[model samples]
Each structure stands twice: as C-alpha cells, then as structure tokens.
Target: MSCYNHSNPSSFLLMGIPRLEATHFWIAFPFCAMYIVALLGNFTLLFVIMTEPKLHHHTSLDLLIYYFLCMLAGIDLVLTTSTMPKILRIFWFHSHEIVFKCCVVQMFFIRSLSAMESGVLLAMAFDLYVSICKPLRYTTILTNAIIAKIGLAVFMWGIGLMTPLTCTVSRLLFCGPRVISHSYCEHMAVVKLACGDITLNYVYGIMAANFVVGSDSIFIAISYILILRAVLSLSSRDEGLKSFSTCGSHVCVILVFYTPVLFSSYMQHWGQNIPTRIHILLADLYLLVPPMLNPIIYSMKTKQIRGQVLRPFYQKTEVRINFY
Candidate 1:
C-alpha cells in the first residue's frame, strides 16, 4: 500500500470586517445581538406559521409562503452561525487561523444557502403566478401533490448545483500564504489561495450562477410582470389595490434579499477595486437583514398576522397607555 500526504494550505489570515479602532467591540456586540434576534425571530415565525391552522389555509399561496419563509430563516441561521462567530472571535481574540476543513465547510455552507435561496424565491414566484394567472384552477394546478413535487424538484436542483462547487473547492491543493482577504471563507476568497489551477473553478462558479440564480430571476420577473398586467386590467380599484397590497410585502422582501446578493456577486466577478469593507457590509446585509425583516414585512402586510397575531400584543400596549 502506498501512502500519500495530501497538500493543504499552510495558514490563512482573515482580514476581518473593517474596524473603527480595531477593538471591534462596538461592531461585534451589535452584530451578535442581531444574530440572536434573527435566530429567535425566524424561529418564532416558522413556529407560528406552522401551528396556526387558520393562517395556514388562508389561500393557496399561504403554504408556499410559509415554506419560503422557513427556508429563508434556515438560510439566515446557517449564515449567522457560520460567519458571525468567526467575526466575534476576531474581535475578542484576534484569531483568524481557520483550519483547512473548517474553511471548506464554511465555503460550502455559504454557497449552499445563497444558491438555494434563489430556488426558494423562485418557488414563491411560481406560487404567486399560478394563483393570479390561473385563478380558476389554482387549487387543481397547485395541489398538495404538485407542491410536494415542486419542493422536491427545487431541493434536487439546489443539491445538484452546489455539490460540484463544494467538490471542486475541496479538490484544490492548499499550500503557503493561505490568507483569505475576506472575513469569511467565501468561495472566491478561498479559491484565490489555492496553489493549483483555479480557472476551471471560476468558470464553473459563473456557470452555476447563470444556470440557477440568473434563470430564477428571469422567471420571477416574468411572473410578476404578468401579475401586474393582470391586476391593472381589473375594473374595481379596491379589488386591484387590495390584491397589489398583498403582494407588496413579498416584492419588497425579494428586492431586499436579491439586491445585495446581485451587488456582491457582480463585484466579485467584475469590480475588482471595491473597498473590502463594502464587500463585507453587502455580504452581511444579504445574509442578516433579510431574515430579520421578513417576519416584520409579512406581519405588516398580512392582515391575519397583523390582526390576530400581533393585535393582542398591541392591545396590551394600548391598555398600558390608557392606564398611564
């Protein structure tokens, strides 16, 4: 039997997100609080949505919305757990030496969630399209069976798309000067340290983005445009306005979710001179802010959630005000 020693990077120093005074106590403290709130908020939303039968059966879109929200929450957890702790560590101890296996895992976790999120958004878009475009047959077209199938298809797509990415990065032989410029084990950041040919990996990454995220955006845009036209041609202003309002939260959530991702991915590919701080800020916003805002958005937009779920809390506050 022949023994082989696998080549690996010597060491990598993460240029942790920008600093005010390098102590980072102020930055890391707020970020940690945000992570904790994000975790609790998302978990609460998922639990409430799943448990409330009235909320669950409100419309054909309800189930899909719940599923999408849950997926986003899960992504939020993965991102915060993967990146925030590292940032916290740097702030507290100034330790940025990420092991080879941990680096790979971090890269995989980030990419997997980022890519799969596109698919989940696509699923929601499809649900909205079918509900509006094919109103009469919405139930028949998007039966539980069909929803399950679609969920399965998206899952398969996400897994298949991300596998090659993880595999490709894992195969790279790491050596000296393994310092990644970014705070986290971002795909491009880690790949840049490879002492091997990374041209193929870069090409594959671009292709992956185009195939999964690019196509999903195109489809979502088309669906919304059709929905807009359909809404515009309706006779009653109240009916049209109500329908538009229902989807407004979703549209806002989508914009907030995708814009940073598009910006970060674009800069990573095309803009080389962007400030490192901007990159870190955009990535953090892409991962953190959306999850925190999602439940808030939906709660405000959804009458049942606002009235039935949030009303009781508000009423108590109103009572306190009256008492005072």
Candidate 2:
C-alpha cells in the first residue's frame, strides 16, 4: 500500500485504548481523581519546601538537598500533567485529535522527564548514601557547590540524551497510518505510524532508555546496599533504625517509580502473552502512580517535611487558642 508522504500533516488521531472504547467514559473518573490528587499533593509539597525558612538558608547543605527534592516534585508535576490532560480529554470528551506539533512536544517532555526522574532519584539516593554511610563527610562531600554541579550534570545529561529523539521523529515522513493506539503520543507508538525506515528510532530509544534506567538502577541499588551495611554496623539498634529512616522515603519512591516502568517495558516488548489493555494500563500507571504516591510517602516518613506541611495549621490553631 504505497501512499504519498504528508511531511506536514495537520494532526494525528489518538485512540484512547484498544477494545475498551465504551468504558472510556467510566475510566475517566478514577484518572481524573488521581490527576487532581497528584496536582494538589505535588504542588503543596513544592510550596512547603520552597517557602520554609530553614530550607532557604544559603549556608545550609540541607538547603541544596531540599532544593534537589523540589526538582523531584517539579519532575512529577510535569510527568503527570504532560499526558494526563490529553488522556482525560480523550476519555471524557472523546477529544482524541492531537496537533502534530503538540504531539512532538508531548513526546519530548514525556521521554525526557522520565529519564530525568531516574537520574534525580539516583542523585537523591547518592545523597542519602553519603548522609548515612559517611555522616562526618556528608557536609564536606556534598557541599552547596558540589550539589549544584551534580544537578546541572544530571539535567544536561538527560536533556542531551533525549534531544536527538525529537529530531529523528520530526524528520520522519508520516504518510502512513495517522491513528496512534495509545491515549498519549508515546514515542514508539508515534514512530510506528510514520513511513520509511525507523530502525534508528527503535535502536536509539531502547539503548537510551536502558542506559538511563539500567545505569541509575544499578547505582541506586549499590547506594542502598552500602547504606544498609552502614546501618547494621551502628552501635545501637535504635541508631540503626534512625539512620535507615533517612532513605526509607527515597527507597519507596524509587520502587514505585521504577517497578512499573520496568514491568511495562517488558510487557510491551517480550510479554507477548499479556493482554494489550493490561500493558497499556500498566504503562499509564507507571506515570500516574509514582507522582500520586511520592508526596504521601515523604510526608509520612520524613519528619521535617511533615512538620513543614503542618506548621501553618499549627500556627493558625495557636492564634485561635490565644484569642479564645
């Protein structure tokens, strides 16, 4: 079936999901709820971290680490909102047409931010490892200058890695099928619809994803292992538990973010026996679940952040009591 190439098509149709068109209206409800929760939780967490006086101090190493945490929140915000609105649009309103330029932008953000999150988590894990495994050197090692450098390096690396993908996809002539099967413009999904050879896209995409996720996971695992060893060597069990708590929230965040990613990746590639709907759902969950759970996990596990969250309420209560 030879068709003329439309180098500049007006738009592409995004099919919400396969074999579940009728249920899309009902499916929109839970997704909307999760999106609302993610917005509130992540925004509130970002606000508290930014406004809290202690976190603003220039001389504080803790300030840099907390600022880095703010990066995680920002990443979560972008990651969730990047695709969810279009997804909700598809499900609720049957608004499945994404502008061609918009689709390219969406693909860039989704892919770049996913890689950035893995790097951010690894950076945080390394910070935790230093804080726990070498308490005395934590301050000396991860200084404000060093932290700033590390953050810069991660962003440069992530963005640099993903920038080529946009070029590769953009240059492809999309004269073939215009209907994308996924709710959002996933990279491979969009690429598949294009005419001509896309072997580079496939190869680069796989290699880049594996490099970011695989390398980061390895480092994160090593960090946690050393952290565990350090915790065990502590003189007291209470001290060990206390030390472990520092990385607990981070550990939870890593698991939530990475597990679904790996599982979904596998299901889409090798798990041929799995249902398409199931794979799609898992992939969607990979983006949604972590953002929703991250703030909750940190709030519950990290006392400082929890206090930052509750301070305003406590102050209001104090004022009311004093007046009464």
Clashing pairs in 2: none
Q: Estimate each model's TM-score.
A: 0.90, 0.92
Candidate 2, 1-324: lDDT as tens digits = 212234857899999888899999998899889888888899988988877776576445467567777888899999999999999989988898999888888988988998888989999988888888887887889887888898888888878999888778878888877999888888888888878899999889888888889999999999989988988888998988887777778888988999998887666657889877877877777788999998889877866778888888999999999999
For model 2 the local lDDT of residue 321 reads 100
Clashes of each: 3, 0
lDDT score of residue 103 within candidate 2: 89
Q: Which model scores highest in TM-score?
A: 2
Per-residue lDDT for 1-324 in model 1, tens only? 211126765457787776443656667777777778777777777777777778876676676677767776776777678878887787677887988778777777777777777777888887887777688988888887887787777777777787788788877877757777777888888888888899989999888877776898999999899899988988999978977886798798888778888888878888779877778767765667777777778777867666666767899999999999
Q: Which stretches of candidate 1 lie over 4 Å from their true place?
A: 1-5, 18-23, 318-324
How does model 1 fare in lDDT? 0.76
What residue runs in model 2 are displaced by over 4 Å at the alpha carbon?
Answer: 1-6, 57-61, 312-324
